[model samples]
Target: MQEAKTILTKFNSPTRFEYIVRQASLESAEAILNLNLGGVYVDYEPRRFHVAGKQLARGVLGGVTVDNLGSSGLELQYEQELKGVVGIQRVELSADGSTIPTEAETIRKAVHGSDLILTIDRALQSQVELELSKTIQEAQAKGGIVIIQKPSTGEILAMASMVTTETGEIVSTSHNRAVTFSYEPASVLKAMTFASVINEGLGVGTSKRDIPDTVILEWENNEGNTETEIWRDEYEYETQEMSIEGILTHSSNTGTIVWAQELGQQKLYDYLRKFGFGQASGLEFPYESQGILHDLNKWDPSNLNTIALGHGISVTPIQLVSAYSAIANDGIFVAPRLVSHIVDPSGNMERLASTPSREVIAASTAHQVADLLTSVVENGTGEKASVNGYKIAAKTGTSWKYFAPEDSYEMPNGQRDPYLDINGQRHYTSTVTGFFPAQKPELSMVVIIDDPAPIEEQFYASHVAAPLFGEIAAWSLRHYQISPFKEVQLSDNNQQAFNGQTIQEGGE
Candidate 1:
């Protein structure tokens, strides 16, 4: 009776109410019948208001009663939100079992939630993804990744992956290779080794250990192979009397291993772990792998040599880049961050900022490391990474491997064949990691190109990853207003050159 009174007084009497009911009935009936013209009879029958569509009306409006009505959109996802009540039953049955509705509906309770606001610039992310995809595809490599982070705050500006599935579908895998996959990092570890020496007050600038610019890595004979593994010649060509700076400038494996030896296994492993090598960076990922760092007690004579050169150790790119960021941040190590904040529809903001960076070393020591790394890009293997008008500090790495159950540097016939093949020619995964505006750093990035085709065309990091670093850094520098490093005469050319202002130089 109350339902009848309410329908008569509030829903049917008013012209607008009648119109709304008519429209809803028509739409609902047609939807059920899947036809507009055939559903008029359905609306004509005088049916009792049936919340569960189980009861007939006592009488029709003007001798006509609509049988059904339904809601849409928001009412679809949460019908209870719109004061929709469960269909009640008043009668037992018609030919088909049915029930009449009699209840006042109430809306469902509202649910509270939150949203996230990220610091990643859309344009910058797009640039990095596009460039990284192009490079990896052109290389016909398995897959690759690039990550750019601000050195000061450890804010990740851009990250992209060109990961391919086992099914041959090239896609972005859920795994963040930059932070997850940890592998033996050939010569890239040299930076930390060099930094550890400087921090220990070794005074690399004036060490009097008769440090040869080149050292023949002396190893024992192979267990299976007939090849005798004696001390080979120096890995790279450089004067024996060159300074420690000269070792890193040229990315000398033997030179770096020799220096790390000075630090010794115990101290070197300590510094490596201190630099965030053997643990996760605590990023928001489930698959982050803690890289392998053998305890000093576990080190054999060979491991000491190889780990010194970054072969016996394993590390993720994030660890590697974060370690580099320590140098860029003047000895402070900031945790790498992704999401900057979260916001709701009401514009309520919940900001998520990186934790305060911890001081890993003295600022002076960091500066010393930066000074040497700067030379690496200016006149060394990373020369290809130099930006025209910016201070670029970089290191290039090409790791060699032999086909075996475990990693071994026993190159076939005393050659470091680090190249793989794609399409027809040989390829390699060349990596270049560094930061820009080296004097007052802003951005740091790592470019990794895996097993690129056209090896002769684009094999080394200088040819593959360095150029990419230059492009990304130059764009980022201009966008961020980072002051460029002025080209100064760090070395006399075959003839001569000038520093910024003075022309006083000699070489000829």
Candidate 2:
């Protein structure tokens, strides 16, 4: 029996066996013998013991499993390949009722499950999660997500999400906030607005607009009564004529609205759709969201203004990041993917083709937009997101959560009025999305911090999300050894350029 156990242990299959116990003690063996002698077991089937245990993606693999099959992740998406087929065995027994080993036959061979290889870089993913966890804790944020992708191939390299529990514990959930949580993107959508303007031949050069600190617009109510509403910027700026680049750098809500108006409602809508907004990202994740791009027919005058400033419309972080990837990849929108390929038990590999690419904007237009984003990190609200040596093209977004009234407002004499205050206590979502090596981006990423507390000055993306982006980007660049700007010989007059340059910067 000991020799048999030793032989079995030596032949144990990592792909098949759940666990194997060797050199069992007499007490343990007696427990099984007692059960057998008690006649509680009708039949002792060795085949049942040989079956494989459920193998699931755990920890860093990061996929969800749900009771509803439709909502499951890769477990359901590739169930046929992952589950594999069960087999049957038949044996001819002698008159003594003992199975004859020589007469045993396998009616069907058990097919092993195919191995799914993802595009995720385990090392980079680890760093992303570590940094994201630290950032969320420092900001006392509810949760956060970070997505790193190869801009050229649209392959996701790292995706990390962390949530704070009510008990004040930070833990990782299967919920991929990057592709599932959709919210008003705030100023980050300014990049898309600018892209739309440039794609339509509207002009890359800045458009002059007189931006005011606040603007009051008159509109007819549903009851046919004239009403007025005020739209104000977060920071009061004097009314002055400024260019499109200037608007983006300053992240002016009034300026973005002006540009959206010039682009017109239908054209802007078209551009949004063209950029893959309001559609599934084709990442093949079960819970991926298409986001909320309001229908054109439902567009109100204010919708255009609000949507332009990234308020009226909502978008998943993946959607926004992929859109920026389009700009980085020279205007071609390539759908991002996770599972790269699958290797079957027979050793055959099936590589997944890249998602269909469509031209959203001209290459020249993309380059122009990339330049504008470079300016954003260098001289704009995203300055904090700048890496020491590498040029990062990024945009920052800070959006207020939409408030829903718990009950209708009562008018004079206890009469209920139709009005409900839509403005609630300020809860903000701060985000930063961009690509590095601005001239030739290899990595495009987005970081989102949801409803950060201790909101004294930490509510803004530049303060919270942008710095997180910088940290993660800096770490990723170092891990991948991504060279920053090419080394150039500094002339005597240009010696200051290399003064503070270091091979390694910005990582613990």
Candidate 3:
């Protein structure tokens, strides 16, 4: 028995042989023992834990069993390739249920699973998670998402999603808000509007509009009755002549509406589609939302103003970031990818095909829009996102949450009474998106804080999200050893000046 155990161990087979003696006939048991001692059988097992563990980008969960692959995230996305084929064996069994090894019939070897190499940088991913967790706690936000991507390659480097529990403890979630949650993008869409205006031969310098604090529209309802709707800016600005760059810098809703009106509804819709709004990002993420962009037939006078100001439309964080990547990539739109390639068991690699791309806007138009965004980071709403020595191109967004009628009002049951805040409750989604080394961007990122508290100086994107962006951007640059484009002077007030020159606006 000791010699048999030693032989089985040498053959990499199970060492226990008492079960065979109990279950098999005397002759079969002798045959099994002889086969084991001869070192003729071997078992190759598969792994249960593959890659980084649970909720790695919101994957489904199942028990750790050999047959149970992960249910969500990349696990589900590439399950076919990850789950290798099972091997099969056929043998003549004795009446006692033990195999007669000398009469073994046939066997088919297993094919090992292919390995997936993601574009994610594990170290950078950890850093992003740490910073995002801290920011969500400091702002007392309900949830948040941060995404870092390479503009030239459309490879997602890091994705972090964190949410606050009912107990007020912050934790990472499996919801993957960056690719799933859709909401009004607010002023972030203004950059797309400005880009469209520049692409149609309507020079940014030549395009000027007189904007009012409020716009009143009268239209006929479906019942043929006259309806009146009022659209107002967040704050009252003087009715003055403003250029496209000024509109983006100040984040003026009225200014954007005026330009959208001139650009026409169909043209604006086409440009928005081209920018990848209201569409899936093609990353093949499970349950990924395409967001909401009403068809042209659904358009009304209110939609014109609301959509222009990013009210009526909804967009996911991935979709928004991909569109910005196009601008950063000099107007070429490349679909974003998560998995870089797969390595088969044969030690050969199968690289994923390059995602299709097209020129959405002229390179010059993209550069002009990028320059306008630079002004925003330098002297406008995104000032908090500015790094010390990098020419950052960025935009800030603040949008109100939409409450459904059923949620706003209580039912006839013993529930809370229906009520609406006269000034609208102070709930906001604050966001900052940008690309650094503005002239030739390497990294583009977006940070979103959902429903931050109305605490003093904490509700706006500039105050909440922009600071987080600056921290992550600065750290990434230094970690990646990116050289600064210009000398920077940091004052005690935390303000940064670049080589004694503020980035000048287009048409200067």
Q: Which candidate is the best by lDDT?
A: 3
Q: List the residue pairs that clash in candidate 3.
A: 59-72, 59-73, 60-72
| lDDT accuracy of residue 462 in candidate 1 | 79
Tens digit of per-residue lDDT, candidate 2, span 324-373:
99999999999998888999999999998878889998999988888889
Each candidate's root-mean-square deviation in Å?
Answer: 15.6, 9.0, 9.7
Tell me the whole-model lDDT of each prediction, alpha carbons only.
Answer: 0.64, 0.77, 0.80
Ranking by TM-score: 3, 2, 1
Q: Rank the candidates by lDDT, best first.
A: 3, 2, 1
Predicted candidate 3 versus true structure: per-residue lDDT over 388-420, tens digit per residue: 978899999998877665555444573543232
Which model, 1 or 3, shows the larger lDDT?
Answer: 3
**Clash count, one per candidate:** 7, 0, 3
Candidate 3 residue 111 C-alpha distance from true site, Å: 1.3
What lDDT does candidate 2 reach at residue 206? 66
What's the true lDDT of residue 128 in model 1? 73
**Per-residue lDDT of candidate 1, residues 1-508 (tens digit):** 8756765575445453242244256567677446433212233332223231221110100011233221321112122222323333234433332323445344553333333344556678767766776776766667777788887888777766666567765665433566666666777778888888889887664453344444444444446433222222235344465577887887766566666777777778878888887787755444567888877777766676677677768788878788888889998898877667756545677777665577777888888778788899998988888888666888888754223323323355654333322212343567788877777777888888766664565767778788888888888777766565544445446234443333332111
Stretches of candidate 3 off by over 4 Å are 1-47, 50-66, 90-106, 205-207, 409-426, 486-508
RMSD of 3: 9.7
